[model samples]
Target: MIHAGVYYTPGSLKARFCLAGNQATKTFCDQNNICYDTCGKMLVATSELEMTRMRALWERTAANGLEREWLSAAELREREPNIIGLGGIFVPSSGIVRYRDIATAMANRFQAKGGEIIYHADVSALTEHAAGVIIRTSRGQEIETATLIGCAGLMADRLVKMLGVDPGFIICPFRGEYFRLAPEHNRIVNHLIYPIPDPAMPFLGVHLTRMIDGSVTVGPNAVLALKREGYRKRDISFADTLEILRSPGIRRVLQNHLLSGLNEMKNSLCKSGYLRRVQKYCPSLTANDLQPWPAGVRAQAVSPDGKLIDDFLFVATPRSIHTCNAPSPAATSAIPIGAHIVSKVQALRESQINPGRTLRAARSVDVLHAAFTR
Candidate 1:
């Protein structure tokens, strides 16, 4: 199954840690000959509340055998001359990778193993039986196989619904707009400069990131997206918009985050408002330094009761598994996650084992096969 990399990965959904995530990505890159940078990452804190949270993060990571440092305001200024904040948690190993390059390598490896890949194959239907599963694609193709799995990214929730499982969540698209710092302003930040995120919210807030090419990027304020595949602010699909509007659960969430939603929309529309978000930590940026970059859509899983699904959630059947909620850190933890899923499939094949019992007891994973299949 193809995994959705970084962007689809959520905001502290799986873990409120970046070092572990980055380290995991770095490890994958090293083992696969994928090129990546180790520019490190910094999460700056301004208020006493942020400072206290930073300290807690430092201690928690340290206890987990992770390397982290608590830096002073002056120290932060020395390393990042433009950074303005009280202090921050510095994770030296946190860096960025060329996502495309990593994805290409993985695809090549998959094909090299004699695995057939059908690009642009839109799965339209699924039928499961005691013998096997039949998958129908929009391109007028069909395949029968012993087992089936789905990793349809933004369309995962819909695809899972076709398989007869509710999965207890819906995919709500969130648009995150970004800006590349002008060439001259690239030196303004030495590492990834992130403002401490609100513990109550999933978003990490706006921060400056140094891509693998050494260019600084800022502002990825999250806003509701009208289309799942929409890449531009104006791009919209009437069907997608209608589907989202009809969901009462989604409406409840919008009401819950009313002010926050409006603020994000403001930042998305106003360049200065977006810049001010990053300016909280990086004071050197001017509106002129904001260069245009393509925006990304996040497939955020929202529960039926108006809560964000904040972990790796997988719903399964006798012969198939569907990823319901897998946000950030997924790219970094791909290898381990794949291994974990493989174990679940293996557990199901035991003749004497109760499939439901096997799935539930399989490493604490949330298996919905028994709930749905029964």
Candidate 2:
């Protein structure tokens, strides 16, 4: 819920989960009449060589079961007349939604089915024993679960450490700042428009996105977050800053990607630089056009060796299952992810108990019911 889109690699846990999430999102929206749009996406090629790169991306998308069509510059112009590009690859399936609403809907369905979700009850500690895992919160409240599945978002790394498992990585927060286009420019785009991403970096570059609510937003420039939940430029936490700076893994990672890191820092500091990124697709914009919105922090996992964890990392032992990293597109894939987790947990439970008639009868909704209360 807290992490963003970097915890994935092609054909990785993140990729697989995201693929499942994509389909699951469409289905959930259809079933619940939620406002969702697969308004499609386009990766604009700004140059001839970039056109080839877009082709390669098309191939990757096909492998991932994403249907896409190559669009010539003229065709791209037809779709987004306000935008200009050398050429582009049109992915008709990629779309956007209000994640906040989607989350509320999911929580509602989960609880209506007898599932209990205690929001704001953040778990601070977990102790494993012969019978189950004892979870303790900051308020000293405790709950015993036959198993503990940690999806502790921004604090995932810290939670993993609390469980005494060192994945040898630290969570480095990258804040993505966004700008909503002025109402007059809402007609600028009909689909999600993205710049061809730099393969060397995790970010896919700035683009134009049309939310389900009938507004267009631009930006989401990557910047190093001074605080984990820091949404504003002025927001900073001394303790968090100290923690990141003191982290050897973070230092090494930054050192390794010094150029890209420096560029990102520059963009964050220079409004012109950030505007230039958004202007690639929307040329009509000027400095005054950029408007601030709540920024989302990407809880990027970095290793001591300076490598970012580019795949969905699931660390499972006989005792517990920890979702080390689940970021964006995660909201889109929450249902399938939840179902997959439920299946694995059931399999583990079945290994311990006999497959009896009543247990078999309850198989459909029983474990899912247990998860609600736990």
Candidate 3:
């Protein structure tokens, strides 16, 4: 991401946007001079059985100050001329931004503030002691820090293991493949189009998104990957593959979602099967209109009990704090997450910095941890 610059156009918007952290994300956009669409609309296309649940979501959030409305079938078509669906929840505050640009901007600012940016410095080991935290990089370089935080995405679990902290969660990579709409079809969706996510499934079925480039991209059906860093359909790692198959975590996930797993695999193999998901709501799209787009791999954290970790989980030591699981919305909450970590670091008494706080087990859903006061 630090190397790729051109790919960061028209920021990344996904299935849905939340009223939470919307402001912080926008703040990032403004600071970077990144152009973004604020009045972002994301449509949650629903199945017949999902209407009740969708209605509750709208009811719960509508009163929170943002414009939330239950659009009727007629209303959906009337408002979005290209959409064809029964109806869904409409969130007007949802939006999209160039995430890479935001990251680059943050890096530039960090450097300006006396922060060093080191490229290709993959950490091979981390050790905490009275002297501080010692980091050994893969390039055979050693660096020590007064404090260290781990935000490694796909490799977070492995890195935490090096520091010898385990929260009973393992990261399982699920590759999401997306297809671009031909320029002719780009005008089809004016807002973000999302399928009502199944409560039982870890991944939302395929959805449509309006990128900042005035292009529409569809798909991102979740499929198990053979490697954690593998972004392509065929990219595989023998070691990572073996590790995943042998893990109790992956086994439990497979046992619980056998049919769902197979269906996702099918969607990945057959283009028609994948297209049918998009067709469910956007009937106007045809196979010919689909083009190639880069796919994303999500580092989904799963516990030994077959449940996906839906919330961000953190583990802390005296000299270190590790973000074991942070994916989607993590990008949205980058500012606050950084601030929260800094606050915690600042509050640490020099004497207590070694043992720090015991990492209690808690489900971190939407909110950041309370202010870490001295």
How do the residues 1-374 of candidate 3 rate in per-residue lDDT, one tens digit apiece? 01101111122211122223567677667766888785455455547777765665565454444566678888988877877777876776677777877878878888999999889888889887755789999999999987788788999888877877675788999999999999988778777777776667776578788888888888788889998988998899999999888889889898899998899899888888889888888888888888889989899888888788765666666667777776666676565566566755564444365455543323333334355221
- Off by more than 4 A, model 1: 1-13, 16-24, 351-374
For model 2, the stretches where C-alpha displacement exceeds 4 angstroms are 1-10, 350-374
Local error of candidate 2 at 270, Å?
A: 2.5
lDDT of 2 at 71: 84
Instruction: For candidate 1, list the clashing residue pairs, or say none.
Output: 9-327, 9-328, 10-327, 10-328
What's the residue-level lDDT of 98 in candidate 2? 70
lDDT for model 3: 0.71
Assess candidate 1 and give its TM-score to the true structure: 0.88
Model 2 lDDT tens row, 38-96: 77777788877777777778777776766678888899899888888988877776777
For model 3, what is the error of residue 273's alpha carbon versus the real structure, in angstroms, after optimal superposition?
0.5
Score every model by TM-score: 0.88, 0.88, 0.88
TM-score of model number 2: 0.88
Worst 10 residues of 1 by lDDT: 1-10
